[model samples]
Target: MSYRGPNVVATSNADEKTPAASRDNRTRSATTDFLDPLTETEGLDLVGILSSVDETAYVWDLTTGRLDWESNAAEILGFDDTRKVATGAAFHALIAPEHLNSRLEVFSRSVGADRVRGVPYRLQYRLRPCGQRSETEIRVEDQGRWWPGADGHAVRARGVIRIMHEEYLEQQRQLVRNDFDELTGQLNRVRLTDALGAVLTRAEREYQPCAFLMISVNNLAVINETFGIEIGDQIIAEVGRRIRSKQRGGDVIGRYSSNKFGLVMLGCGPGALRVAAERFIKAVRETTIKTSFAQMTATISLGGVIIPDQAKSVHEAVNFALRALDIAKSKRFDCFVAHEQLPPAEGARLRNKSIAEGVIAALDDHRMRLVLQPMVSTKTGKPEIYEALLRMERPDGSLVSAGEFVPIAEQLGLSRLIDRRTLELTVDLLKRHHELTLSVNVSGLTCSDAEWLTTLRRLTAGNPDVLRRMIVEITETVALEELDQSVNFVDTLNELGCRVAIDDFGAGYTSFKNLKRLNVDMVKIDGAFVKNLADDTSDQIFVKTMIDLANSFGMETVAEWVGDERSARFLKDAGITYMQGYYYGMPFDSSDYVKAA
Candidate 1:
């Protein structure tokens, strides 16, 4: 070994102690191979792994202050031979330009020192030429480090730097490719745009209702102003988590923008939409989380569009949902306003252009119709009352069921027209017959529109029989969620001589601590319990308890989905006063409804 370079820097005064010299003497007398590049790189241990490409092994010479031998270390540097030609400086030739300084520092430190610290360092360099050169260069870098051998100078360094380098590169690619919201680790707008089409296709195939909701962290702007953007961001992150925890795994949720999250509600029908909205609202508002600076609480406002039909395309559904979200944002900060149902206001005219143009035409052309579903009396074993179901006929001469298009109509602010048309049909049917009562299910959203409700009463004016015969079913969750506004709604209906039933008794997302919290005349049990009653003892017990509980509170109990004689008998015996199901009768037109009733 020899050195032809300038004078080398010796170890510091502190390093040239007596202990280090004694250790050096011990390394030379160990009777080990002095410098076998192969043994040092490959035969350092009994394990063949020491010879593997991942172990970076090199032979260094203290006297020369340079590498004397590197056994297949050339393989680590993108070659097969390290002992010939390139020799000592070959390793330095492959050192990446960026790592040149660090490599020099480590080499200088190792020579008159206790140890050669790094077995290998990562560097990207072109590969050995396999054929005629091409325009592109094949370069890779592998990463590895070292530990001192049994003796300091006689150290072996071995490891693969290419795969390691590639691994880190891949991680960088993923960091850029991911659609994660930086604040919450939730899916962001980038993910939503990509996944919407796939989700729509599945819903179309399954004949399921798919809803898209846009949720805003209400008062977020105020939060930023009052506290700070950092706290506001913290609140949004917490709100995102709460929303995620509330949903099932398969449901797609993402942050559409700052303070706004998008949700694709799966398998939800129009009948259950208000319930779903109230739940999403509750999930975010009810979350109490403490940040570093303050204890924070939040409310979320939501707006969403239910799928047009299982057959509708993904693009259509996304546009619809986004439309609804816009409407919700234009309204009160702490409220969810469906886009299609936004009243006549700025931009509403622009938003509702297509639906509004077609809806009035559809109505004028008698494209609107009604389908009455029976909600039979449990006691009489006869249909005591019929539920008025709405329907719309598309231009293709096909009827879109109320469960299908009422939401769209509502989103277009055309629900009052729907309500009016339905009432007229219902009354015309009633006048043509006698002894049949009809229950109309209306959106609790309309509860706040006094002019709309007043129009409803005036249209049905001079028809006390119609009013007395009507049971206006508003979802209990919806009423309770909007409790402050519901009082006036209840009073207005009572003045119109209408009986109000709080629909879906215990199906609320919030636990019912006060069964009679929202004053109402009757409680309808959610169909979930009744559907499983035949096999699930828990459901049987729940239904029985619900009935007993409702009776105790002077409210009538209606068991929905009573699909068989056994279910009907069990519910009747359970003291349920009302039952509704396919086994009883499917939805019919006004004439069939009256005849059946």
Candidate 2:
């Protein structure tokens, strides 16, 4: 046999049957015989499978410069079955113009390299079939190898092409589902965190600035309870819509939590972020949410800090915002508070963070302790009840006061834990000492929490005696914010033989209006008014008015922050029935106090 081609070599099989020649020819013939049946079976299977799958198969006769494909190829290309073959030029034209050069380069390199290495050629490229106006595109994976004919003069390329349209579509759908929140169609938390981190890293690299804001729909739980969950969802969706509409370019927004969302503003300085934060607050506050139940206006609170400078990581940035949001909620709704507005010292911030962490640990480890601050009754001139105060035992044998960590616990949504802990401690203490009466303070947030209410019910169910000696102090802020719930709580406590006190009574602005709604046994005037009772005339007047109001309502009054005998005498002469302050005694371990008595 003889061959004449650029990639072909000539060889002879005409020699007579010499022993050496016979062995060599027999080896070649045996190899050829083995491959013939294998190739025939594979080719038939490939054809059958491709035809059944409605796929395309093609062969390139390199010597004749012809491209021939299976009949289905014409249909796949949006053409008639009659045109099942094309020359190289027509085959090349099937590729999209934009992908043509790149496709050709890839094909050439793949084939050339494989040919050098005696390997098969394979590639994937985008194809927009020619002679059609459908404008549809498909990804085709080509697999081919060089094949030589019997004469060694014909070189051909055979391959199979598979369309990847379905695969590509599925991949796109998966990406969408992964990155988007199904309820609000916003970025989900995981993707949002990733994007925010990316932006933070880029901003740091470029020496730019960014800001993050954590926004929450205020009292979403109340809305869900009053209306239905459907209405609450509509409110959240509307909030997302308003935020998207008001977003500046390059701002990323995501659903951070159930009722909270986050915003990332790229290259935003503090002043710019403040203005933007105000705008966002206004936008959501002004938009009225229309649900099936009723139309309602909602307010959102924003708490955030500048990134890359103030916050070094995503977690820190979010914590900064969370800390601010806690302050905002404490002050008023529809407000924006930046992290810098908090304590300026890094030590303060670290302490707050550590306190937040300690709360979580304390909840799990049962490390919460209670102390008793004696409340002396002027009528009896002796301590009648002790206020239960929360203290966290530190790892280093120290204690953290509630004043330092209670707000943090509230901010971190651990108030209910604290409330439950207090109840447990109070129950234990009351069981230990039959003569000791104790008061425990609960946050306004806890008053509205269903879990906390359940906990309260459970605590009172087993031991009715505990309720007789227990005084549950609901803060003035909580009572005012959730007046209806607070009233119900007070009524339930009274019915159970438990006394209720309006704690920090004059701290909130709605004291006068809401105090009448609360049918309680005692009112603890806020320490702010009592702290300066000896000198400040206005403080004295406020305290006097509060005491008179409580007396008129048939509620006993207790004055706090009476730091000296003068203040104590002042409260005593003002008809304050009880006095609790440093002057009487500081908070001491409740267990020890009960034991000493």
Count backbone clashes in candidate 1.
21
Backbone clashes, each candidate: 21, 0
Worst 10 residues of 2 by lDDT: 6-15
Candidate lDDT scores, in order, read 0.65, 0.76
Clashes of 2: 0
lDDT of 2 by residue, 1-597 (tens): 122342211112222223554434543342233234754665545444665655666665555444556545666545433132244445665666765665344333422233332336666777766543547767777775655454432356656677767876588689989998988999999998998899989988999989999989898999999988989999999998898888898799999999999999998988998899788889988757788887899998888888899988887888888888888877655888888744468757686678788888987888899888999999888999899899998765689898888887788788878888888888888888888899888887767677766776676675778779999998877787777888888887788788999888777865565777787899998888888878899998888888888888898999888898888888989999999999898899876984556
What TM-score, computed on C-alpha atoms, does each candidate reach?
0.40, 0.42
Model 1 worst lDDT run, 10 consecutive residues: 7-16
Q: Pick the candidate with the highest lDDT.
A: 2
**Model 2 stretches astray by more than 4 angstroms:** 1-353, 511-513
lDDT of 1 by residue, 1-597 (tens): 322233122322322243645434433322133334545776664223434534333334333323322333434444543322222333444444564455445433444344545444555444332222333234555344433444443233333434235666688668756867777887778788567667677777776777777788877899999999999999988888888887866788888889888887777766566687787788766657788787878888777777646226555666666666666767765666654543468446654566666678878987777777777776667777777777777786777677655666787678777676776776666666677677777775677776667666676775788778878887777787788687668777777787788777767743444455555677889898888788889998988888888788788878887788888888888899888888888876665653554
